[model samples]
Target: MAFFRQLVGKILKNFNDRLSVSAAAALAFAVFCVLKAKGKPKFPFVNLSNFMLVLQKKLVEEVIFDGSHILFRCVNQAQWHVTQAEPMIRGKELFKSLVQYRCQFK
Candidate 1:
């Protein structure tokens, strides 16, 4: 149809003029962020138990650690300092004791 053709032409013309994916512009924005923000120091971790203990200690108040992760939280607070810190934070003793309890026969 003539109406459809005209509508499609107008839409494609606008898109061609407006759309952009400039690497230089993206690189400039990234550089601004790197210059503006100071990042946190990374922690050396071997296992979940040690990681969880350190994270719990950093919180403003006590936080309950589920076997695999932290529970629902409050508004002013966040659980872990780092995104990858969760699975690494499990309590070794608690987990060991749980496993023993499950395996032992009465």
Candidate 2:
């Protein structure tokens, strides 16, 4: 996803007419958006005995998953970063992101 995003950024930079450039570049941009798959899990290793242990509370609240989009409210923060908001992941990725988000406190 990052590769495609950087590639699209490079592609967009070559175009002279930014306003009327809706040809091949537009299709490439569309393809980049479509590549938003549920990426691999990014959680840390945990011992078998401590698998159910939670170190921190959830930062996000009231998650709503209605098919395509996942909407959720964020808790108060000193700085509103990407972790404060939902990453548009579904099912497994959602769980991974939730874990990653809460793990910041630990």
Candidate 3:
């Protein structure tokens, strides 16, 4: 009976240790997420409508295309950047539209 009790106690101790370790890991992850969310500004997705608005409002002053990233300076003096994950065709379409819009204004 004593041996059985000892075995059960050891099992419970091991389970408790694992539970504490898991809880600590979860807490750390939650803290990291909170920090990340607080630091980042949420920008609107880059699409046709947004691009049109940028053009219509003359919000974008300069646009820089670097490989998979597009960086632009707004009239408000704020700079915004986006990394494109879409296919090359979509990027080409966006570039064409931007050029068309700029040509119209000029």
Candidate 4:
């Protein structure tokens, strides 16, 4: 029990550090937005399908599938990592959706 508590504390500390870094980056981005609001060129609008297509091409460099979760590594030198928990639904719909998206994109 003591070991588990220490492990969880370390994990939370690491997560908090990462969150602070992300917050700083987000602040910098907001500064850029404020500057760009002054007579800057408008960015092109992207719809969900187009955004999904772009993500399909560049977002996931590798996928590590575990029993009930997935880890996705982006193509940016392992800088961006995402983990998603599997949805609880009848008939393995999450797996089916992934296959269907793969086929559709192909």
Q: If the candidates were sorted by their TM-score against the true structure, best first, what order would they fall in? A: 3, 4, 2, 1
Clashing pairs in 4: none
| Model 4 whole-model lDDT (C-alpha atoms) | 0.52
lDDT of 2 by residue, 1-106 (tens): 5986886686677567666467657867677566644454333333322321322545544444443433344466332212212234456566567556667765
Candidate 2 residue 48 Cα shift, in angstroms, is: 1.0
Lowest-scoring 10 consecutive residues by lDDT in candidate 1? 80-89
TM-score against truth, every candidate: 0.21, 0.24, 0.38, 0.33
For model 4 the local lDDT of residue 86 reads 41
lDDT, candidate 2, at 9: 81
Q: After superposition, how far is residue 68 of candidate 3 from its true place, in Å?
A: 3.0
| Cand. 2 Cα-lDDT | 0.49
lDDT of 1 by residue, 1-106 (tens): 5864674465555555444335434545675677567565453323445444443444224334455544323236654332232444367576455434533533
lDDT of 4 by residue, 1-106 (tens): 5864674465556555866666655655675676578664433343435434544665556654554544444566544333334444124466558535754663
| RMSD of candidates 1 onward, in order | 13.4, 12.7, 10.9, 16.3
Candidate 4 worst ten-residue window by lDDT: 81-90
**Candidate 2 off by > 4 Å:** 1-14, 21-33, 36-38, 52-106
Candidate 1 structure lDDT:
0.45
Full candidate order by lDDT, most accurate first: 3, 4, 2, 1
